[model samples]
Target: MEPSYILHTKLKELVGVHCNLAAPLHFLGIPFYRFAENTLQEICIKRGLDQKKLLLHLQESQKQTVVPSYQSLSKSSVDVVINHLKSTHMWFIRYRLPFISQMIQDIDSQLFNSPEIAEDMKIIFPEFMEEFIHHIYEEEDTLFEYIRKLYKAKQEGFMNSTELFYLMKRNSIKVYAQQHQDDDDEMAGIRYLTNHYQLPAHASPYMKVIYSELKKFEEELMLHSCIENEILFPKAKALEKAVVLKLTQASKLN
Candidate 1:
C-alpha cells in the first residue's frame, strides 16, 4: 500500500502465482505513485479502481499490503467467482489430488535418496491427502452451495427475499468462514518431503515428472485459496450482513 513498495517492487515478485498482471499493471499510466502514499481507499479512488471491492481484497492478502495479482478476479461478479471456485474444486478433487496420490504410491524406498524423504512420503503425504480431501468436501457440499444461493438471493432480493435472507441469517457466513481451516500443514509436508521440490541428480524420470506436476498443483492450490479467502468469502459475508440488517429493520417496522 505504500509508494515505496508499489513503485520499487515488481508486481509478480509480490503476488504472481498462476495469474499474470503485467499488462494491467502497466495500464496505470505515468505518476504511478500519485496516490500510493494515501490509504488503499484513496489510492483506489485516485487510480479509478473500485474502492469498496479493493478493501475486501486487501483484507485477504495474508494481511499484507502487496495487492494480490488476481485483484481483477476480486472485481468479478459473485457468480463468476463462484463458478471459477467450483471448477477449481473439481480440478483438485477429481483430477489433481487423485493423480498425485497415485503417483506417490510407487515412491521407491530404494531410490528415495534421503531417509527423510522416505519416512515423510509414507507417513506425511497420505495424512495430507486425507485431510485435504476432507477440507474439499466441506466446501463442495456445504460452503459452495450456500455461497451460490447467498449470492443469488443477494441479487434477486424481492419476492421471497425475506424468507431466503432469513434462512441465510440462521446459517450465517460466520459459521462457514469459521470452518475455513488452515491447510499449511498439508503443503508443508509436501515441501519437506520433496526437499523444496528440487529433483536430485540420480532421480528417475518418473520422480521428476511427479515433482513437476506437484509444483503445478501447489500453485493452483494457492490461487484457489486466494479466491475464496480474499474475494468470495468477504463479498458473501458483506452481502449476508446487509441482508440480516434489512430483515431486522423490516421486522421492527411490522
Candidate 2:
C-alpha cells in the first residue's frame, strides 16, 4: 500500500476522518513531537528527501562528537535534553530493536534469492544490523547510564570533578553521535532491502508487513536525527553549559 494511504487508514481507525495532520506527523517525528507537520514538511522538501526517506536516511547516518562534561549544560535545559535523549534514543533502543530483530528473522526465512545475492546480503546486512544494535546497546549500557548518574548527582546537590566529568561527557557525546550515525547507516540498509529484494508479484503478508514497517521506521529515524544534529544537540549543549555555570556560582557563594 502507498505510505500515505496506509497512514490515512491508520489514522481513520484511531479517530473519525478529519483534516488533522497531527497523527501522521506524530509517529514520523517522535522526539520532536512539538514540531508542526507543516514545518517538518518544509524541511523534508528543502532536503530533497521525502519525509519517509529523509527520516530513514539520517537516522541511518549518525556520527556525533562527544562532550566530556555536564559542566557545560545549563541546569534548566539539562532536564529537557535528558528527556529527549531518553525518550528518543533510549526508549527507541529498548522497543524498536526487538521488533526489528524479529523482522530480520522473518525476512531471513522468507526473502531469499540467488546464492550470490544471499552472500552479498550476508556481508552487507549483518554489519548494518550489528551497528544498529550495538548503537542501541551502547547507549543503554553506557551513555544513558551516565546520564542517570549525572542526574542523580545534580539532584543530590553535589558535583563531580570538573575535568573528569568533561572528559567523560565528551566521550559520551562521541559515542552518542556515532550511534546516531550508525542508525543512518542502518536505514541505508533498509533502502538496500527494498531495492534488492525482488518481491514476488504477490508477496506474503508477513513479507509485506515487515518491509512496510522497516520503511516507516527508517524514514522517521532520519527525520529524528536531522532534528537532533541540526537543531537539538547544539541547543542542549548550550543549555547544559549555562546550567553548569550557574551551579558553579551557587556553590561559590556557599
Candidate 3:
C-alpha cells in the first residue's frame, strides 16, 4: 500500500510548528557525526523501494533559508537556545532512550514469532544504541563546549550578539542559515525507518499502539528541529552580529 498522505501532511505541520536546531541531532533524525549526509541517505533509502527512488524523492523536498528575526538579545545569551536544547534534545537523551530501550526488549520477546519485524527491530535497535553514545559525546564535546566558551566570552565582556555574528561572518564561518535539512524531511525518513518501508497495519492493538507512539515521538522531534533551524538560528545570528557591533564600539571608546 502507498504511504498515507494524511500522516505526511500532519507530520509536515508538526515540523512547521515545532522544530528547533538547538535540539539534539539524533532526535532530529540525525546523529552527530556525518548526521546531515548519513541521515539524508538513511531516510531516502528507508522510504524508497530502492536506492534510486530514495535519492530522487529526497532531492525534491523543499529547502529553507532562514531570515533573521528582529528580536534583540545577546548573540551567545544561550537562554532560548538552552531552553530549546533541553526540551527537545537533552530530554530525548535523558528520557526517551530508556523507554525505547524497554520497547526494544518487548520487540525482542516478540521476535521469535514475528521474524521479519524482529529482524528489522534488531537492525535499527543496535544502530540507535551506538548512535546514542555518539549523541552524548556531541553534547559534551561540541554543543556544551561551545556553550561554555560562549558563556565565558560573555562573562569577560568580549562581545555581544552583533559582534559575534560579524566576527564569524568576517572569518567566513557561515554560521547563520546553514541550510540544515528540514525536520519534516528528516521525519519522513524516520517514518520510513520505524515503519520499515511499510505502514502499521490494523492487525493488532499492540502493533497499532507502538506504531502510533513512534510516529508521535518522531513527529515531535522533527517539528522541534524545524523551528530552530528555519526560524530561531537565523534570528539568533542576526541578533549576535547586531549586539557584537555595539560591544565593539563600546570597547573602542574605552
Candidate 4:
C-alpha cells in the first residue's frame, strides 16, 4: 500500500506474527510483490479504498496465525538451532515428502492419460524426496549431534576435558560441512515432468492440490535450508572456533 506501505518486518511486529500473506493479499487485488517495496496504504489507494480497510483485514487475518520466528534465530543458541533443524527434518520426512509423493502419484495415476509421462512423473517425485530425506538423516545422526556435544562441552567448561582428547576430537567446521552431501539436481526431473508444475486452466481439485502441495514443499525446504546452511552452520562454526580457541589457550598455559 505506498506512502503507508509497511515493510514485512514492521507488519509482522505490528500484526504480531511472521507469515507469507502474498496469496490472500493478492486476492484482494493487492499487488503482492509490491510488499517488498511498497506499504499497505499504497495498495489500498490502487484498490480505490481507504488504507484503513486494508490494514484492518491484514491485522485481523494476521492476528490469528502463529508462524516460526526466524528473526530471533539470527544469533540463537545451539540447542534452539538444533531443535529447529530436527523439527524441520521430521516434517520433511514424516509429512511433506510423503504427502507430495502420494499426491503426485494419485493425481498422475488416476487423472492423467499418457502412460509414459505418468510413470516418469511418478518416479522422479519420490526419488528426489527420498534422496533429500537420506541427507537429512545423515545430518541428524552425525553433524547435529556433534554440535550438541561441542555446545555441552563448552557449557561444562573446556578445561573439563583432557587437552590431548579435546584436540584429537577437534575438527574444523569445514570438515563437518564437507560431510554435508546435498545434491538436489535430480529434482529437476520432477520439474521437467510437471512442465515446471504448471496446471492446466481447467485443473480439477486434485490437480490443484498436487501443484499447491509441491509448491509449499519447496517453500518450506528453502526456509529449512536457509536456517541450516546460513544461520545454524555459521553460528555453529563460530561456537566451535571459540571453544577450540579457549582449549588451545588453556593448553598453552598448562
Query: Which prediction has the highest lDDT against the true structure?
Result: 4
Model 1, backbone clash pairs (residues 3+ apart or across chains), number: 0
| Ranking of all predicted structures according to TM-score, beginning with the best and ending with the worst | 4, 1, 3, 2
Write the residue-wise lDDT of candidate 3 on 86-197 in tens digits: 5566656665655454444554334233457656765676566566546545544544444434444555656565656554445321332343332124334335655543
Cα lDDT of model 1 by residue, 57-170, tens digit: 433432433422477778887777877777777767776666566656655555445646665676777788888888778777777777677666667654364677557756
Candidate 2 displacement at residue 4 in angstroms: 26
Candidate 2: worst-modelled 10 consecutive residues by lDDT: 11-20
For lDDT, candidate 1 versus 2, the one ahead is 1
The lDDT values for all models are 0.60, 0.49, 0.45, 0.62
Alpha carbon deviation, residue 235, candidate 4 (Å): 0.5
Tens digits of per-residue lDDT, candidate 2, 1-254, equal 24454233433231222212322333444222122233444445555646677445434433342532334333335455556555666445555544545434434443333334444544565577677667666656765555555555555635555643574456555456566665555566657656744455655433444445456567657755665565445554443464466567766877
Q: List the pairs of residues colliding in candidate 4.
A: 1-39, 1-40, 1-41, 1-42, 1-43, 2-42, 5-39, 5-40, 6-39
- Tens digits of per-residue lDDT, candidate 4, 109-227, equal 54544446667767776777777778778878778877777787778764464753554376556776655524433356666777777877755444455556566777777677777
lDDT of 1: 0.60
Q: Which stretches of candidate 1 lie over 4 Å from their true place?
A: 1-71, 158-166
TM-score against native, each model? 0.62, 0.47, 0.50, 0.65
How much is the lDDT of residue 72 in candidate 4?
A: 80
Any idea how many clashes model 3 has? 22
Q: Of models 2 and 4, which has the larger TM-score?
A: 4
